[model samples]
Target: MAQVPLVVGLGVRNSIVSALLGKGSEKFNYLHRFLGRSIFVASTLHVAPYLHKYAIDDDFVAQLGKPVISTGCFGYIALILISLSSIPVIRRKAFQFFQISHWIGMVILLVSLSVHVPICLPFTLSSLSLYFLDLLLRLLFKTQNAFLGTPAVLLPLSDGLTTLLEIPSLTTGWRAGQHVYVRVFHPGMGLGKMWESHPFTIASAGAEGEGDGEPLRVFVKSVKRGWTERLFGFASDGEVGTGEDRMRFGGAKGGRRCRVLVEGPYGGTGNILFSSFSSVLLVSGGSGITFSLAQALSLQSKALLGLVRARSIDLVWIFQSEASLQAFMPYLLPLLNNASSNKTASSFKALKINLHIYITRPSSQFAYDPSLSTTLLPAHDHLYIHTGRPNLSDLVNAKVEEAAMEAKRLNGRGVNPCGLGIGACGPQGLVRSLRNVVGGLKGERMGEVGGVEVVTEAFGV
Candidate 1:
């Protein structure tokens, strides 16, 4: 009973289900938690009958000395400790302790189970095999060998910063919007010394840069907490943003470097959703633009090659300051430039690519920057910059109108256009608000074709 649920949950981890769900696998997280909770109940009942039958006699102590009996008792202790430590409150407060204890407890329990009922040894071995196989594969295949654990050059900005690693040798191409799990090692310790890894959207795509580029760029807002705070001390992409010793890094002063191991090209609308839709609206907040950029570029690539059905891509990004918008320009420029040069987006003659930039907090100097506008692309209009937070309800309503028009153009009799894939990756609050908007919009316009489907990746701080 215990192993059954665990196996079903852990088995084929990189199976078809994970491939389809991607980072959206959180939907199944509850199932794992529920199954885990049942282990305690099942073990308690199974042991009750044994205790009732044998307790309160000289023979009880003697009987427990047998290998099977003793092993079962020890395994029960292991299960109890693991269950207690796994509670949400305790786990959250002391994750490292919980993690260490969980693994140790699991090992003890599995070893005991193998001996308690020798016939079950195969099951224990199978469980351990799956766990180690997953770990080994993650280490061996997740990282690109050429860029496998390389030191990155960091640039801190007044707002956010970007990291540049030597992915110059990486050959595997990644779609935009997909992210990599990054593990940074201390300088001189080498990238192989990976202990902590965090997921970051690959801000730069493989195909859009000035030349063949590696998955070397990730724009990050250096908020003061955990990994983000430690990053500033290790390096910077521009002028160092924070920390007491904010020194300039350059060739003259041996460029500051932080080693990192890159893993994955995981999860994006382009991989599963965008290719099927004719019109897509990407709503983003702050660095969430990274998620949208990849899908847009990917959809464009496919459309140019007659691979996808998407013809219209609209990006609405919200940032705190104009500097952030400036900092993120590198990601946008290459993608747009690449599209302009690639057959002029000829798939849909009515194809209209919209880039809307909203700055929530403008600096005092914002009043002085002349010519805030820069030429973006040959076919489409340049960036449309707006002030303050966007009216998201209105934004979705407008998208709905576009969808209606698209349906009409398709020669349908009031048939809904293919539903729009509206994706976002940003702050949790932004996702919630967008979710509300999408939900209400969908409900209000039930019969509308080309429904608004939201795919959200909460870019946690």
Candidate 2:
């Protein structure tokens, strides 16, 4: 029974440490760092009592006179220095020196902790078990591509954004809206050297009858500063040189050169084709449209397979500029055309996909069509173009509610009141906002209406 609290406390500490090391989002990283400091405090508290007991009851002071005790004491002092140096004030004084010393202090801490806990069978075994589990998980991921027989190909699109990639091995076929983990391999950089690998939707796959030579595509956009930027470099072009020189210099040279290791095509906006819902509403911000684009393509392909029938798909992509759309046109144009042609042939029965591009930062070079309006959209749906960054959550929520109301007005029982499945991929804050909006509506509309689903993909930690 006494082990219960200890287990719970250790579990909490483990969670905090894991979050600090896990991939995805700056918010989580900040939380991890904060919680790591708390763990240090807890660890200190845990060790203090044992030390006190040894000193008072066991006359451990006599043992302290030994050389080993002197070494351990110095090690503990170094750990304190490292902790203190992590404070902003001290770190700012000598950043490089502090970083090197921090590593050294970590070595001392690990050695001291091992010695301090040695022969304590329970604690040592527990720690070893956790360590081995982590190692096993890493090993599994490292060999994933070999077992899956897929090679990850990264393509750097212009506009300083990597919006496309190909996986040659996933020829068994991947569904639209499914995401995979990508780890960049940098030679001479050592194993597991690739920083945080984030999830991106498989925007489009090769034709249904296509061979294994065909590659799966993934879309990505760059954030200000993060692990993605560190590994891939800030510039998307091939200008970045390989080897240590590149890491030292930073940024790509002529084109983006990065090797990626992919793992698991997991979780997405629920299987759209198999769902009973007839309509889908896809609302995205900036590069967040990746998953939506994939889903739209998936639904079209599934319809061709004669699997399920969906009424219409309304896609709203909010971007900072028209360039974003044009930049991704190589991938988007085909999907759009297919959806359009299929809708016409089916007499707008099986599936209808309409694209609405919202330009938040319209430049003087690009002119807006005066005749183009949101009302220009079809009777059951429409395309909306905005000049500036519109509130994505508000727009999506309002659109969903409007679609639901329209469905009810038509006495349609199959249409979900929550509207359509919403899949988003982009920066963390934007994703969080969308999640909150979805969460708020989960009980009110989403729970009762089986039509809508929300899927999100974040960049990195």
Candidate 3:
């Protein structure tokens, strides 16, 4: 019974210790997420034997008085909190709650398990050490402002749907697809105020900024009841309507800027896509584009500078409306203009970047019948928006097959097998779908499609 918890303890370490494991040496591939179910099973096995013994003995109530029993109870309680909070429905509905529960549960498990089981003392120490290391590193690399960290100015759009943030003093050493945790304290910091922080991907290409103290830009959606809502609530007081009536909010207009704390640029270091990959596919949905845009630009820069292994780049972006596209133009324009530039090496003369956009719910004028598959007016560069949700499975499956065939053709020339890297960040369902598709494609055709490498961007942590 005591040993069962050992597995649960090890699994917990694997899940959260990545923050301490530096990215340059140990890039957390998120391979340990499956440990959630294993930890739950181990927790059940560890507790069931004790519960069975308790049921047969009338002294079970008296046994609760024992310090060991009471201490063990906390470990059980933490397990329950983690198990229930990890449910997909609960996790998706209230991510912040799940995050808090998991954190508290981990602390309880560490402290209580150490008191209950002497052997667990080392495990607790190790986890705590890693936790402190992560915090210390965050502070070391954290951007510094005049007073606090960074002064992030939030500019809410006319529609009140999106906000463009201009953040000063962004931390250095951030990779293309890395994200930062932001804690927004409206009207600057104050005592007794509850702080809510969320992880948002750095949207702009050089969001780390160049030289001394350039500003980093990112887009935040004004989701209802989301942390962003409270951060932008100051601007919501004035008149609210679509069109130019409201214009953009923040900076000069109304003058609202919030002080924020930024932590980490976790997951992969430097280049997101492994430098060895020949072809790269970037998939994004809605704000997930924040993860893809910077990566795409980095790949372009590498290809243009004659330092890239990837020749073909396919970017698949899905959105709800054209307004969303226009709102993101600030980040996307640089990539497009650079890719379409006339100057560059002959080898860099052509970058095979095929951009595909899928719009789920467009304007009233656009025809969309749910009964039909899709109503797409596919064009060259500016493809017409699609009417329905994307069939992600079919799309990825086809790409895998196509990449495999191309790799086989290149193998005859005595060249090494071409590698395909597929990276996606989006809604949970979409990210899960991409992961499923990638998992299903693994070990196909004698491992021939050169090699298919997949990286999923998840905000679950």
Candidate 4:
């Protein structure tokens, strides 16, 4: 008999049930909330089993009078409030009021849960670690916002796509390919001041070494009736309007700064490239190439500074259309030119970096010469561009396998070297795909090769 998946066997059966029930349009957000509730219920059950085993014999009710137990009681109460308020019935009945209360209840739950955690030093240390991580990301975000000079700014990119943002700072340096969270306040929509935040990669770090102190640039494609359009198309200037206002005007007037909360320079592992890997293969979809570009530019910069040694770097950027490439050109051109010039000047084995642009959608304006070498010259670093979107799962898996094969090829000659580490920053689906591919490669070898390591950066939760 085939063994059941560990997730189902562990009693976390939601995934299995969802698959059996047909993962149709129940909405993922709702499913997420439901899963959270289920986790909370499971935690409650764990406590109950212990309570039942000890309560009768030890008089646990009397022990509950202790401060820790009292705090846990408050936590339980807060959880109830969170659960009840999160219910569709309550939310539908009084949407606005429920929304307001829900936030407050979540805050209370977080606080109570923190207190309910064990008072042991290890627990405290773990809590502190999370707190510091949040704090550091917040600080970096705030600094970026301030340097931008306005709390926020809304503008259009090359295409009709719009981006609404607030940056209190822009002077704190940001590497290329890093992303920031964008929050949109739309007036008179659904509920009031109900803002939605999402991550967008920095198109360019904004004219490196140029002392103008301008805001960092980001490229965003509007999707249906979402927060980006609401903020970019509606919000009034300087009015602190509701979601409705943002949906109408695209921006507020009178210098009312966008109030943005920034978080994270978090996940690009720069150390991977510094290792003894012979070559680097970077695969990205849509705006996901921003992180790869940043690494390439950083590597070029390091080469310029005579910092480290590397063989070559290859970049594969895949997007839906030529328009997407055009939108990214303002940022990408400079980096490419810089790398090209650096190659010309360096005799120290030029770090060959090749860029391949793959446009999935065919358009008259998007055609490229087929003769273009994906390789960076002098070192003959290979660059291969293929049109059409590669299945993300297949691409990740193939890359892992290829890296292992190459490692084995080198190892057969008695020159075993660490394989390239894959890094990606993208949407949930892509990140999840890459993560799975990485997990599968861990401890698996190709031929006589060493293993492959993958690094990823995911936004929000």
Candidate 5:
């Protein structure tokens, strides 16, 4: 009963929890899971003594038959199911089942819990009230305007392994690193596909100069054999076999048009301002570049307008294969060119930008554009492309040292430097590794760099 409101608060988007704690669901979902486990353990402890007493008194069967006891037993069963199904491996493999079962289990648990213990009614009612209020407000404001659907274009890329979604009409603008939910309408794909909404990070930094009126972009990688696979197929002319088959039919250039509901602009660097830092580092792995790319562009835009305290911005992107580079060239080329131009701009104190690309696997069919290699390669001082995985710890330390040196130089000229901000958005492994590296930074190292702040947006539930 005591944990009721806290559980609901942690689960809901617009709740007192978010208001007081200032963290969105994306940031604190792990805490919700922890509290849920606590509820399960408490429920178990409460039930054990009741069962022991009933058995000792020899009224076990009779007591279990009562309405209160039966309902409590059912609620415990529901809680067990919810807990077991929520295991990461099971949840990822059977997401729909997990999602459906969770909601159903919650309903059963809440109803039975109230009936089993009348004293818990007030607490349960309060939880329900908070949940519904969150739902009502989310529907009325945040996700309401997008229900009717907007025209979207889906273009397959990266040897048909990824689909680029372009929603040109969604020009309302969004914060850097934020994501939105997209529900596409495909008549032939069945009702499940139509009703389901998937979250994808916005790749374009929409409120800025060049980004104004630019379509909201999302790079959907075919990582699983589920909704994303189906979406990739829909975008790639419904090719059934191998990736080569899809590409053989000129699917890369073929663009599919459909309407989709856009439900967010949620989950970003909430109160942390990128412009407030003296140096910024953005890191991403695979498709997670969408978040980092948007952040980099937004920071650059702010710097150009002299609205930022940042003087240096570094972007580190890791790709599994060289072929993946082709899909991002459209965005990468322009960014490199802009960074190169910024270096020569004498009149403005422009942000020094550096782009580091690390390709972990180099296949024989390496599809890098020859023109880009010739033009943007060694000539561009800001772009560095390397083979093999990066030594993240070493790289971070290098940046810290560089920032510290620059701070000392600036201090001699009577200027104090702000802190270094590190933002990472990627797979669990990458984010975890980065976090460990940042955590290891101790007293002198941290202070020499003014200070260091870390923000992360990790993939997965």
Candidate 6:
């Protein structure tokens, strides 16, 4: 009970525990709330008996004056505050306040408990030690210093709402679906941004060859305010002036460059062997495309080397408008173009790849241009783009049916059925819908497909 917070809080330093539990640190965040509630309940149970006994004897004042009783009372107050601040509504609406109060409340509770009961010192010490160790590990290994930070190029996508960051220097290998914390250093970003580190999923796959270097890429969407808005402003500042100056400052030759510290390669699909799946479906919404994009690219790279068993791969991406789809054309084009063009190995050519893009909103800035996509993308049979929201249930059912058919084919050939793998990363609503869709699948449908494994990626504090 005492160590629950330790497990819930530790991220990188608790990799062993995460691995043992078959989940990444971020994946188990729901448990943080649960553990917090359990702690508060247990604490109440322990303290209620003492309060009742003191009140019954009419010695409440005397007991309350004691060091242990007073400390315990203070700790309980802190616990109550912590629990209250952690409520979903409060936490979401006032995250900064919630975060600060949580930290302060934890310190008060832990210190009070240590003083209230000497026997609890070991638990308190252990928790503090592990918490600091994770911080130390993040500082020493995960984070690159601002002074030594690598230069990154920022390119605003066609949407005018998202920015693409590319860092060629930091070639550290990371698994697909993993994310990193980035702290930018730039003159225009202000002091507030200098100390802030935000998490973004790695958009590109890892290095394919031993000596080959792959640039780290991530897509950041700017909201109305905060760090991301400033970043977008800085990136687009060069284009503020009219005429030839804009051409000289903003295009491919003069994209904004900023030095940034990258800390991570954390929080990925844990214990899920992607290559083992015979059929794969990757889904993403808006900027969440980064996770699915990386997974698809990595699996394709692995398949080329005969390391993966997947025969077919499908990607379904839902975007707010055509602008977002156009923005991702550069990345999506290669995946579609290279499917059958790899000359080095014939086996790689045999991998069936399909891409589906759904644009839910009409283009707001300009009319949808069909030529931009058609000219860039080849006339591939498996590529599709739709105008409305996708039927998630139908899409999922189609994949399940494909997997079931593949399983029968494999069994007929006396080969083992490798099952289906579904990876989804998006808004909470989308994730919930997908989960319900998958969960609602009949048992026979599940069994016929060998087995369906679903892995989801999401981020929040």
Per residue, candidate 3 scores C-alpha lDDT tens digits across 266-385 of: 555344354467667889988888778777766665565566676667788898886675556445545555666724544655455666668787888766343453212212352334
- Sliding window of 10 residues with minimal summed lDDT for model 3: 245-254
**Model 5 lDDT tens row, 62-124:** 987899999999999999989998988999889888888888888888898789878988877
The worst-scoring run of ten residues by lDDT in candidate 4 lies at 1-10
Tens-digit per-residue lDDT, 365-396, candidate 2? 87655465322222223334557676766767
Stretches > 4 Å off in candidate 6:
1-15, 47-66, 145-147, 185-187, 208-213, 238-255, 344-347, 364-378
- In candidate 3, clashing pairs total 1
Task: Locate the minimum summed-lDDT window of 10 residues in model 5.
Answer: 241-250
Cα lDDT tens digits for candidate 6, 1-461: 47544543643334556658656576766666667787888988998998889889999888888999999999999999998998989987676578778879888988897898888888888777777777887888777663588777776655777877888786656888888888877667877676677889998887856435358899888867767777777777644324463332223322477788888877778778778888899999888899888888777777777777887699999988776766677787777766777646555544557999888886655443444545545566778877789999999999998898899899999987878899989887888789889999998888887788899875455
Candidate 3 has an lDDT of 0.63
Model 6 residue 20 CA deviation in Å:
2.9
What is the Å distance of residue 344 in model 2 from its true position?
8.7
lDDT against the true structure, each candidate: 0.64, 0.55, 0.63, 0.53, 0.78, 0.77
Clashes of 4: 43
Query: Which ranges of candidate 4 are over 4 A from the true structure?
Result: 1-39, 42-77, 80-102, 108-154, 162-179, 182-198, 203-215, 234-264, 270-276, 345-350, 363-367, 370-385, 391-416, 437-450
Q: What lDDT is obtained when candidate 1 is compared to the true structure? A: 0.64
Winning candidate number (TM-score): 5
For model 2, the superposed segments whose C-alpha errors exceed 4 Å read 1-38, 48-115, 118-154, 173-178, 186-201, 205-214, 220-260, 266-279, 306-310, 343-350, 370-384, 406-420, 439-453
Better of 2 and 3 by TM-score: 3
Which of 2 and 5 is ahead in lDDT? 5
| Model 2 TM-score (2 dp) | 0.63
Candidate topping lDDT: 5
How many clashing residue pairs appear in each of the predictions shown?
13, 15, 1, 43, 0, 0
Better model by lDDT, 3 or 5? Answer: 5
Q: Where does candidate 3 stray beyond 4 Å?
A: 1-57, 103-109, 117-120, 142-147, 187-194, 207-215, 235-255, 269-275, 342-352, 366-387, 390-417, 435-449, 459-461
Candidate 1 segments whose C-alpha is farther than 4 A from its true place: 4-16, 19-27, 44-101, 146-153, 157-166, 187-193, 207-216, 220-225, 237-259, 268-271, 335-352, 361-382, 412-416, 442-447
Compared to the true structure, candidate 5 yields what TM-score? Answer: 0.90
Error at 156, model 2, angstroms = 3.0
